[model samples]
Target: MKTSLKSAKRLFVALIFVALGSCSIAHSGDGHSLKVTASAYNSVKSQAHGNPSIGAWGDHLKPGMKVIAVSRDLIKMGLKHNTRVKIDGLPGTYLVKDKMGKRWSRKIDIYMGTDVKAARRWGKRTVIIRW
Candidate 1:
């Protein structure tokens, strides 16, 4: 009985691992995409997640802002590594830039649950800049 119980527990654990692994795989290569809400903006923190946003962090942003990248897989999209890229996360809209740097303004806003490390690695690398 003890051996059979242990076997069942191992099988259950294996199944859970497989399920979790599959989910992460599905999310792999897939990231939340944002848009350029304003038309012309001064500049931006290339990689950021939330609050006191990119705009508040800087000066000279406007509607119809020009953008620099499509996704975080920027290097894959031919973006030079460490180049300053920008995107707008409009509160209630979703916009994704196409490969050639054109905004396909969307009605839904995509939110990236970004972290400090991600922002630092991707956005402005200044040590004093807080998220």
Candidate 2:
């Protein structure tokens, strides 16, 4: 009876591990995806208040860093600070380091690091994002 109870306990532990592993795997690559209006912004006095290089989450914005500012509505939708984002038509990933004003909704602003021209060139378009 003791051996059988031990074996059953071991089996239950193994099953719990399997269940947890599958849960992580399902969320790893298959995270939440959303379609949002994407635009670009530059780190300049006219664009950012106080310190232009400082993000809303207090992350420093340097040139060539892949970071984005999400709208307030998107924040409520799981795009919280420091969230990793996979943007369609863009390489690698971007981090959500800042946030837009309350007026903005369902939008994301790509950081261009003081390059106003580049920001303007990016313009605005609808793009899919995954996290």
Candidate 3:
């Protein structure tokens, strides 16, 4: 009976470790991971000045594109133009095709095209991004 109880305890500990490990993997991913503020934006005149569909790096943005605008500070951290990134809690990969203003730091703006409601729904939150 004592041997059975010990085995059960060991199994429980192993399961707990596995659960913890999986949680970290989901957030940290396989490559470099960073925690930053995430928001959503629309390609509109009110939101984007001058040419709304043109990115800071001269990339043309269109509707239904999976792209993000990274803060200026993130460029120094290897998140340069055209970099692919994986955002936690979001499916698929997002390309870094735009750039935020200098006032923002450690933040990313998800491009939502003309979906103003979706951008508003996204709001602002802290998220982990992998590159």
Candidate 4:
């Protein structure tokens, strides 16, 4: 009876470990979730330069990609360059392509290709982001 009880305990412990390991594996490739404030920007020549300097990825911003500039602090929190993120209210996912300046914290800048008016309209708002 004592040997059987020990065996049952061991089996229970092993099952718990398997469950937790599976949960972590399921969430691994899918980036973690975070809530953040977001704004928009455009590359129009009139308002500001149309081109961004070399990003953390060591390349210029691609025109058509759904990309966002994340705050420096967020980068420290694992939202690093090339990380894919999903905006809660938005329809599609975005990539972390650039890093914001030190003055900004907990903010994300959505890149709207050459659409100055759209960027201005987007403005700023609190939104849920999954990275």
Candidate 5:
């Protein structure tokens, strides 16, 4: 009977672990995956720097865009550029993190914009940028 009880406890713990794993993987997706390459943020930086060729860049941000609000606090929490994360939308931020975040600059901001309501969705994130 003790062995059976132990097995049940182990099974319960395993089930909880699996549930939490699935929940993490099921991060918020504004009805789309919005696979944006790192180049997008790079473009923003260059454009902000008066890059003439920036005009030919992709369309500006729209609503429904998943906003990855990578802020100074995110850095404090260990977030870095090019770091991928699964986070829920808080109407102005995302819980992003990275491994090499401790050794990075603190003047860069990253945002994502999809063809959908990218701006609105992005607005829900902390990475605020004009479209």
Candidate 6:
């Protein structure tokens, strides 16, 4: 009876570990993750200074594109233009279509097309991202 009890306890512990591992994996997406501050912006704001390029990649900004702008530091951290990333707490995948200024670091800017109000509403927040 004691041997059976020990085996049951071992099984229970193993199950708990498996459950925890699954949760971590689910949260980390493909297992590559980073935490950074995120904000929202639109083309108008981005081009206010007469910059002609829609993005660093030269792609035109459009609604429903699911794209993101990463800081230069993030680009050095492997978030190159056109890389796909998944933002925690936000549904859907986002593509890295733009690059932020040199002064920014560990930050992401979500593109909201021409919706200035929506961009303003999003503001800024710390978010986890996975690639």
Which one wins on TM-score? Answer: 3
Evaluated with lDDT, which candidate comes out highest?
A: 3
Q: Which of candidates 4 and 6 is the stronger one according to lDDT? A: 6
Point out where model 4 deviates above 4 Å.
Answer: 1-31, 45-56
Off by over 4 Å in 2: 1-29
Q: After superposition, how far is residue 118 of candidate 5 from its true place, in Å?
A: 2.7
Candidate 5 residue lDDT tens string, 1-131: 99999999999999999987654112233321222212123224433445421222222333334333343433443344434444323244332321112333222223443322333343322221211
Provide TM-scores for the models. Answer: 0.23, 0.76, 0.77, 0.68, 0.27, 0.73
Model 2 TM:
0.76
Task: State each candidate's clash count.
Answer: 13, 0, 0, 1, 16, 0
Return the candidate ranking by TM-score, descending.
3, 2, 6, 4, 5, 1
Give one digit per residue, the lDDT tens place, for model 2 in 8-127: 999999999998765421244578787789999988989878999999989999989999999998898788999999999999999999999889988999999988999999999999
Task: Report the error of model 2 at residue 77, Å.
Answer: 1.1
- List the lowest-lDDT window of 10 residues for candidate 3: 22-31
Local accuracy of candidate 4 as per-residue lDDT tens digits, 50-107: 3454454565765576989899988987888888888887888898887777899889
Which should have the higher lDDT, number 2 or number 4?
A: 2
Q: Write the per-residue lDDT of candidate 1 for residues 20-70, one digit (tens) a residue.
A: 765411122333232222222122355333322343223232334332323
**CA error at residue 92 for candidate 1, angstroms:** 10
lDDT of 6: 0.84
Q: For residue 85, what is the lDDT in candidate 6?
A: 92
RMSD of 5: 12.0
Q: Which pairs of residues clash in candidate 6, taking residues 3 or more apart in a chain or in different chains?
A: none
Instruction: Quantify all predictions' global Cα lDDT against the true fold.
Output: 0.33, 0.89, 0.91, 0.77, 0.36, 0.84
